[model samples]
Target: MPRGKARTAATARKPRAPNLPAPFVNGTILKDLRKKEWKLGDEVGKGGFGLIYLAAEDVDSPVAQTAEHVIKIEPHSNGPLFCELHFYQRVSKPEMINAWANSRKLKYLGVPKYITHGNHTRGNENFRFLVMPRFGTDLQKIFEGCGKQFSKETVLALGLRMVDALEYLHENGYVHADIKASNILLGFDNKQEQQDQVYLVDYGLVLKYSPDGSHKEYKEDPRKAHDGTIEFTSTDAHKGVAPSRRGDMEILAFCMLQWLCGKLPWEDKLLDKNYVADSKIRYMEDIPALMRACFSKGESHGEISKFLTLILKLGYEEKPDYNKYKTLFKDGLKKLGVKDEWKLHLPVAGTSAKKSVKRKSEEASECSTPKKKVRGTPKVATTSGSLQHTPKPAAKPRQGTPQTARGTPQRARGRGTPQTARGRGTPRTGTPRATASRASIKSPMKGDSVNSPQTIKSPAKVQTVKSPVKSPSKGNNSKPSTRRKVKRSRAKKVDAWVQTSPR
Candidate 1:
């Protein structure tokens, strides 16, 4: 090597701390990368694999100043951004987005639209960046802003929206391995429809399990189990099995519970994956009780219980009945006598009108009041209040309303549609509770039109391994510390797939 050239190469390398990459300088111009000129702004977020920056088109360019976007950049040498770039090229296409949205009868899909992506060179290093529309805040931040917990109705509404997004992704041959509140962002545009939307972002950990339109065979790969966020990962994830439709629903259920209760049962025991796993088992074993602890007593709680129980019953490889799950939330709204729409309208910014809904307890009489039969056509009484039914035999006396432990009234039926009245009966207040003290705690390749191939970087040091599912405890189980050590030893034998980065 030439002396002068070698010295220049040595000088270009920055002294980086272990595991952290070289930081990208703000205001740095990435030249010839995209059609339009862009200059970087402040760092909006940082993660294990890359940094996210606010980007604006240069002043002299033809674009409007109001058009702001977010750019996610990782080392040009290697990262998951390369994988994501290809996904956006296919899934985020304008026509494809429109098709999915129209099929679902939604104003917009809950996914970030890809703008442009390319690589920028700086001295001896290259950095890859992807530009996407900027969004408001994540559900995590909004949860904090609205107080630690969300109302039961609000949580159900959010769950319904998330299911829509996940269903779209699953149908499109992808699985969102990481499903949590932090990954969900609300839109902030001036358009009302956009403002009412929530998007699932950060596809770095996503996997294309059904690349060719069939779900991959489920096999236990201990190394791959529990490859996502610890607290909300699916049981399949814990077992080192590949994530599927059921896994996504399980994770979403955890998010809903946390949003309602303000914390998860295993939030404090994050370090012990086995403990967390066992706790989750106990949670699923008694879904109704968990719902009671988290959600307020009412139709909302009953509906949420049904939704989760159904999710729990799903097979590891089974396709879910999306409409049935959606109907659970819709039926809850009907029973509560609220609007059929998922979103509750907050009064206009300056208005003093308070938002409220009738409680299930208050609706007891209304639900119990039987309809009177008429011999002739029903009365057409309109403007003025009067009996609507033609006279026949007077209706029987109202039936007694059964109440939940928390005093929420429920409806009873001899038989009804879909048997929706199953869990709304009297609550079992004296059921023995399980042990509440238990603790514990993507993919590859192909194609592409926009993203170019890059070399893989050296693996970063292994951090904590998350449990996707807690194995059911047997007669005598090993201690958590001992079990963790065994898992760690096994992990050392097989290299864990790197998460790469975030959305």
Candidate 2:
């Protein structure tokens, strides 16, 4: 782990109850959270780190009738508010808040607007709290409402907006170490335009990637691996390196991939860090296979593959070309013939929905058919944890002692049976010879004669023997002789034959 960069897992430790106050009751007066005292209403949310309450201005305040806000209270000793405070303060700066928003034509950069922050003592407990404008439910809630997956168009739009948010953060030298659907909040309004507006919240895991204008170098530390959410964390993060610009983009790629596919490759291995890392590497090595595994065939997944590839190519200290990615999604929308509109009714019959219908119909047809009964010898059960099986003895020959392949009567051999031929003239009649299994057979020598019983040959052995042809001297530049060419051709045929033959 880098010096001064070690972070405990979010919510790993809870504040001692004696040092933290119990949940505030409705109408409890909170002092200094805003211009005047604010009254706590109902408990809105609770998390591993803290509790959130619906807060409104106290009756005496001039803006008492204003819209309600949310107050997040945490134990002063341990909570995410300290880290989040820094991010909110930086982003809320007048010149920085909308620096890129206008140019991008986004309604707003998706950060929760900061209201106020302060510390308070409730009876024996001292606590830290932050007040911010309370928005609608997070994307996780919406994802559940819409089923587990989002359409490609919806995911693309979300990706573009998140890229912008990350760009703003990177330009200011910060990175959102935690970027997941639950941290993203949908716009509060019921209107379609507002519904499409997405905000990136939860900055408790935020870290400065390039503090003092110097980018953080990549470092590999096993202890630090699995720093963030296991399912979507970047490979660099898995190596325990401090999160960087590339790490942010990599996390975003995971998010978009999950939203499109309904699950991530590492979701099943959430508790196993090493397995998740290995699975990520394997999937990345074959992105096309990854797409096919996650999505139905014939879907336009090339764009996502390209997007993920771009992130994979980025170096730890390198800044991403945000405009290039933004343009990529923009051009994708145009190619899909989607109009220049961010808010519109989604088609009831989408690609994913259609594929879902097809799958259900196929499943129904399969269920409607009856399965055929298989009649044959039952398979033998093997002992668990052992690969070897004891061979069952062959059945004796039927009826009146038939003649063996070697012209011997079956009964002539005492306490012995006939052995099968090895693609040869005759079978042996005696105690079975200890012939090598075909899989264990070695290549026959050139002088060995297959017709003779002593020189039984296996199908073909693929030994990677070097060609006997010798190159002419470098300075001579002479062509090979006819004899050498003939030898080379023969060698090629033997090589091909060896590879094609059954083991």
Candidate 3:
């Protein structure tokens, strides 16, 4: 086996993503495209190396509304030309084929459609520009705009699909160095699937497996370059050790943990798990998964902790048998009185082509426009430090507002955006809100928003007369005050239903 990393069994299933020529402004190709009459429109997205724009090129005439395209323009500098041309020239219809393959499904993983690429020149410079379809929203933007959560099932289904995509890439001998919510595209294909399917974007750092079996990998190998964000990076990457499939798994594990728990693994080994494992850290990565690495109140509790435990257990070294998990899910869902819990048939890859899937309640939640208030389990608040200001109500709806618009297939709701500014007006990139505190809902920015109030931020501050609140069973904050009383008079009202649910 090549020393690098083995693509997990999952990634090898799909075709390699096409490597189209990256474009740039003031390039010969841009001039050529200008000659071809491709007019640039608004800026679509940004990358450190290039800028993506929405463009329209007249096929027949400049006046005619032609096809809209996402054009990529790399920054001009002294680097490469022929090598760049060769790589982009190698790009082809694989992207087109990918688009065709996913056109029909409830494709919520928001990836832009691939169009074409070409050479161009302008203002004493020459470079390449590539084109693709356009839909302009990311998970980050969606969370900023909408704080809605998917059903529990939506989170699971979407999580599995993301793993599948990663597996497909790995199988093809490539590793998505950066895997995070911002990198995951949304609102590109289906307006609704933005919340369902997560599009994996920005493959610039992707490591293509070297053909020679001598490529580097994790300690098992030694030459691999560490590439990825420090926050989500794996133990091997941190150690300057080679990378392998486990590296990706570690990153994947980190992403999953962040989704459910709101923080990175805390144990000191989390900082250098592979290094420690190679030394005397007896359990290797096991401790980090259990939060034995570090312990902070925020990182260790709330709903995120609850589900992350389940996911971590799923990743144990001993091959996980999801059958029992599925069984437990079946029973738990049944006990929760989930309706329409039936089997669905899906097309399997090369068999007689039949697979059964269960349709859970969260699917309906995605499509349920008229939403109901869920008296959820207590969670941590993203805005813990600030006192919630009683701002004047605006056009935005409450968390319980029904979403009649159907998002893609059911996904797990453990994931939501945390709109905290790291103290600056500039917001931090999305963080998990599965257990967000109530005080965090201070922001008013608009997004097609995909997150919700499902988080367990602070139970002490958020609940009101309109919605039922679950008191911490044994926290120091609990008191026999009027706030704890469920009953409210006309001067303040209370609900009788509070007596039934497990308060």
Per-residue lDDT of 401-461 in model 2, one digit per residue for the tens? 1321232222122222232222223333122211112111334445543432213343432
* Top of the candidates by TM-score: 2
True-structure Cα RMSD, model 1: 34.1
TM-score computed on alpha carbons, candidate 1: 0.61
| Top candidate when judged by lDDT against the true structure | 2
Off by over 4 Å in 1: 1-21, 31-35, 59-67, 191-195, 292-300, 340-503
Model 1, global lDDT: 0.59
- Per-candidate TM equals 0.61, 0.64, 0.45
> Residue 16 lDDT in model 3?
28
TM-score of 2: 0.64
lDDT of 3 by residue, 287-341 (tens): 5435543344434322223333444444222323334434544454455455433
lDDT of 1 by residue, 259-299 (tens): 77777767888977666766676777788767665655443
In model 2, how large is the Cα lDDT of residue 157? 80
Deviation of model 1 at 76, angstroms: 2.9
